[model samples]
Target: MSASNNTADREAKLQRNPHGDFNAVEKSRPEFEEDVEFHYTRTKDIEWVPGSGATSDDWKKHKKIAVDPYAEGRDPLNNYKLLIAGIVPRPIGFVSTESKAGIRNLAPFSYTTFVHHDPPIFCIGFASSVAAAKDTLANIMETGELTINIISEWFVEAANYTATNAPPEISEWDVSGLTPLASEKVKPPHVGESAFSVEAKLVTHHEWISKVTGKANGTLVIVEGVNFHIREDATNESFTTLDPKILKPISRLGGITYGRTTQAFEMLRPSWADEEKREEVKKILEK
Candidate 1:
């Protein structure tokens, strides 16, 4: 085989099983436990004052080292791992799309975020360009429509299963056993199990070229959410906000780790117009 063929085989192998041993890894971990209910409580330092800084002073004692992402020995994966680790608790976009031939596709992407609210805009990052796009990105490029489902604790396992690197002929929906609900404006059906989902249309896309190789390394897709489907139990009558307790949204952490929104605290934004709050801020600034 050629050198390129060998590299491709190695990459395919790594993609299929990023973690070397699976059963042994699970065996080393603690048994799965249920009954971890969501807790709503006050902030950690409710009585905190401005300019007090971090709650703990231990952070001050530690010195920091700067990292050059393009260092001689550093590979692209090094930067990828570092960024993902530092950017904690990313929201997963469980995207569903359909090909022109009606082949359904489902996948989860950690590089997804809500960018705007007025026109309901979202950004999804793909590791490849339209020419070499994966199933999800390819489908979106072809049909210009998709459904972005929010993963929850109840169906997290099923949702995660959709990430399996299956062939184009296989539908992730069948593999994950997730039910697809009909969509209004889009041809792609949203996952019925998702409590919160949005039917989105492709607004624009940009292919990012690598500075070193001058090759298309990534694609940034901008989508506009046309319709939102929120579970009745998860939203109030006003439909302004969603209850974290009912939503049970799951977040992607570094590496193979995932996080839950079981505990939360609220903090009100202080206003300068309020004399009392203004004086407090002035005191901190003057100090």
Candidate 2:
């Protein structure tokens, strides 16, 4: 074979089996070159020492500091601040009821949520305070009827005023300076300022144990909606809709924070559509 032809064949063989020479391969690929050594500094020596005269009781000293800041007070404002700050975006239940003596009572509760739709039932958690429970729960227990006025942003302030401590006989409608409108199904006058209200009957009552006092606390009354009152603009031919943007429902948050529904979005899901999308993804992955 020609010298140039032989040289080309040798180069191809060497390229294919470059590790044929172990010493040459070791020289070309240095062991230390596989990993780099970065410059580092050690500032202090870390040594293990047993106990160092520290007692386990030292941890007990921090117990007071670790306690919940809210557990220290009995003030309603403080309790409200903690509840409002922690239980975020709570639905507002503006309840209206009448006493056996024909006195009107209207109040607001953030610890309220819808329970069932078939029977249209909802519940409100009220504390056994002289201010809140006296007129509302006391009256409901007496008359067995109530009207839950769903509050919007416009009337949130008036609803909040109803939470203020007041005399048992004193009506919050008068105290908050809001007019009362007559209801068809119940005697309790609905808040004229509210956008919507539902007359309900006291269907059930549930009692819970208090964590703070370790005693049986007040009851949570389940109310069933009977008649509903919606504003003309909110009611349509097919359904009564209260737009969150227009109604601006106010909600409770953890601490003393209040949330207002300023925006809303909708999502629709069909079983067949979702299944088709899943099958399409599976086919693409298989390919």
Candidate 3:
């Protein structure tokens, strides 16, 4: 069976609410916390030295075991699970693309990251192969353009709904009930709810071949941001930095977990030219 068909078949066997009804499931848990605020706090309250290892004392109490990725009994799914959990707080790329035939797609890809700034390069990892490209990957390859929206806490549920495994004909934008804004360069539109968005063009892509199966496994696409849209209130005069309080970016975690960026602490890079920095490093080295 094809990849899409497999996904459809799997989805078909599932209930709309696998647990109890949506309302019951929601009521069982604490109400969604919406009053969270972004604030700065010190990483550690103690005076530190260069070689001061982890502040926590319990770290050395635990021992780690290693496993071969290709061990006879190990499944590839285990690796996927391990990786997703180990890499905490991944940014979601709420990508929007229009197929050559004009069908629109919107989906959130957690395998997304900004790699460079000189030419403004961003990477999006697609689990499917080029031959079996899904809607977002297919549209990006076909049209060579896409808009990447940053999902904020305000519209995260809407952004996440776009990940539904709907048919190609169905518009995820409509399913998400998100408003779209016309792009300056790309044919695809950007999510208007996004505080920051990037209009990007496909630069190049690479397909990975499985070592065990020797089959096409995945694809990594590189895109160049042609234009950036930042909410005026969320950025400074020069638009160099965005306020985390206003952006309230949502992050992806293991399993069905999502994270918030409501708090942060800043640490300055030490300059060797400063006497205080040199003395600190010198004392650590002497010990």
Candidate 4:
């Protein structure tokens, strides 16, 4: 059977027997018998498939699926779900902020990205629904100070709990039980459990308005990092690059899923500095 048909059959079975855990359904299938070692996939030396036939230039053509986000028949919830699901493994910004009244607020956002490394700028996006003088965005606007903490495997559970939609007076740090480390220049404190943290000041923010509805949907806040606190053990010999094995940072996948940085591989770009590398690339293009 096709993969889609198999999935539908599984759903049908689940509907008929809605008791016990999901394992009950899986138990009906045979166990995997592959000779996999270490319970995870690992990179190995590669050997390209050796074939001597007319190679098709189509290169395994895939059916192009087009989606109109603003289609009249489309549901807003479906658009949100599809976008979040397709954008795999987004980094979470564990943001800490303090209002001018001294109320502390902590939250995690997946829509965070490093705008630039030089002068050290980072951006954290907040949904427009949260713009009304409250929460992280309001606290930052009030104090102009915020600290970003890197969430590692050791305290991800505590970091995850901080994303709760608590009252403006309530501090998520109270429920998370994460120790706050005083930032050097910023008023907000960083998470003591985080191996890496950045004390930053708000530079500016951009409000995003939907073209269709003329409604504001989100605000992207840009901040310049004033100070970076890096744990000695987590850095390399120069203290510039961080060791991924030590950090073990978890990233957001779709829905309630998360991904681990357990397996990785690197490929170097073909440099014009190397004559041999340039010639090899040129030969491939000439084909």
Winner by TM-score: 3
Q: lDDT (0-100) at residue 245 of candidate 1?
A: 81
The residue pairs found clashing in candidate 2 are: 84-253, 84-254, 84-255, 85-253, 85-254, 85-255, 86-254, 86-255
> Is 1 or 4 the stronger prediction by lDDT?
1
lDDT of 4 by residue, 1-287 (tens): 43334435544543433345757866887864333222234334332222323345465576768999888877555666677678988888899999888989998888887889888999988755334434788887777899998888778889888866567788999999999989989999999988889999999888888656686657788999999888888897776888787777878887666666665766446455574455455676577
Query: For candidate 3, which ten residues in a row score worst on lDDT?
Result: 9-18
Per residue, candidate 3 scores C-alpha lDDT tens digits across 1-62 of 69888556644543334465766877899877878699888877457666668778897799
Quote each prediction's TM-score: 0.92, 0.65, 0.92, 0.78
Those runs of model 2 whose alpha carbons end farther than 4 Å from true positions after fitting are 1-83, 129-133, 270-273, 276-287
Which sections of candidate 1 miss by over 4 Å?
A: 1-20, 275-280, 285-287
Q: Candidate 2, overall lDDT?
A: 0.69
Kindly give the stretch of ten consecutive residues in candidate 4 with the minimal lDDT sum. Answer: 45-54
Model 1: pairs clashing at backbone N, Cα or C within 3 Å:
none
Question: What are the per-model numbers of colliding residue pairs?
Answer: 0, 8, 0, 0
Clash pairs, model 3 backbone: none
Question: Counting only residues 3 or more apart in sequence or on different chains, how many pairs clash (N, Cα, C under 3 Å) in candidate 4?
Answer: 0
